[model samples]
Target: MKELIISSINDNLNNAVALLDAIDSKTYSDDSIGPYYSSIGSHIRHTLDFFDCIISGIDTNDIDLTARKRDEILSTNKEAAKSHIHTLQGTLLSYIDANTDYLIHVTDNMGQGKVTVNYTLESILAHANSHAIHHYATIGYILNQLGIDLKIPGFGYNPTTPVNKREGI
Candidate 1:
């Protein structure tokens, strides 16, 4: 189970890297799009920050989701974002055989109030994986607006998405 989870995370991060590799800085940082006005780089950086929070809290067993370092460079420079992704991938790989039974204290404020909840490492990792996929879907939308192709299979779709739909059925 641990190996499977780790592999899934690594695969997702690789997909993110592929998307970044396929676009230039102008496409990545452009936020002139309608509705949300958010860039693909912002989404990717946000996704990476969640994982970073998890990894940083592993030792202390206290993860603060709201206290993320929203680095502007990460949202502007593709090379820097890729480097951060590789760092996260290495960190996750190192935890493959480690204990996940310990509780992780996750703190977040969902517009109502700040809430601190307890979760196992495995659970938070699962959440982070789903979160990254959600962001990737948004990034895909942005990519489409910018006229760039991800060129990576299943770059944004959830795993349970029907194959026909994923193939544009």
Candidate 2:
């Protein structure tokens, strides 16, 4: 289970890496296209921030989803975003042998107010993976608006989602 989870997360992160490699800096930081006007780099940074939170609090067993870095450089620089993803991938690899079932406290605001809840390490990782995929889908939309084609297959789709139903396929 641990191996599978790590593999899935790594695969998703690799998609980000591939995108960073394919696009130019201008396209990465371009926010001119969209109703929300969010850049592809911003989505990548936001997705990485979720994993950063996990890495930050995992040692203490207290994860705070709101404690994001939100670094402007990461939001606009493809190189910085790629480096951040690489660091996260290494950190996750180090935890491959750790106990996945260990309980941890996660704090996040789910509309009303901030709340802390118990979650297994595996569960939180799964959540983060899903969160990353969600952001990737948004990034895909931005890419489409920019006329950029993603070379990675299933880059912005959940594993369970049907290929025919995927947006911008």
Candidate 3:
């Protein structure tokens, strides 16, 4: 189960990079599909930061402070954002894989003892996958609307698609 979870995360992380590579960064900004709701870069970065920061006991305040598309620092720093996302993705997944035992230890931060139990590594894996896919699919739709072919390595219209099942359409 641990191995499966780790593999799934790595695949999703790679898919993120593929989609990032396919985007025309200049055109994906305040007026883009997700915009204030969730920019592609911000979505990827936030997912990466959430996993990395939460596990490392680092502050996630910075991500929360990031406002709308017009206020995004990553909009002009596409390369840096991609690099940050890649680095965080690798670190968090590796950390989780190495510490699979933590899956059973509930780190409940929810208020009033209303905390939910810790996610199994598999559940956490699914969370991360869903996070990235949700945002990436939005990006795909936006690009398509702009008549831009993403040409992604492993992504399809369907969100749950595995990399192996996709052939760069």
Best by TM-score: 1
Give the local distance difference test score of model 2: 0.88
Residue 142's lDDT within candidate 1 is 81
Runs of candidate 2 with Cα error greater than 4 angstroms are 166-169
Candidate 1 structure quality by residue, lDDT tens digits, 1-169: 7788889999999988877777788998999877899998899889988998888777987899988999989999999999999988888999888977767799989899989999987789889999999998888888788776556787788889987667410
The local lDDT score (0 to 100) that residue 114 gets in candidate 1 is 89
Candidate 3 — what's its lDDT? 0.55
Q: lDDT of each structure?
A: 0.86, 0.88, 0.55
TM-score ranking of the models: 1, 2, 3
Order by lDDT, highest first = 2, 1, 3
Global fold similarity of model 2 (TM-score):
0.94
How many residue-pair clashes does candidate 3 contain? 0
Error of 1 at 2 (Å): 1.7
RMSD of each: 1.6, 1.5, 5.7
Per candidate, the number of residue pairs that clash is: 0, 0, 0
**lDDT (Cα) of model 1:** 0.86
| Pairs in clash, predicted candidate 2 | none
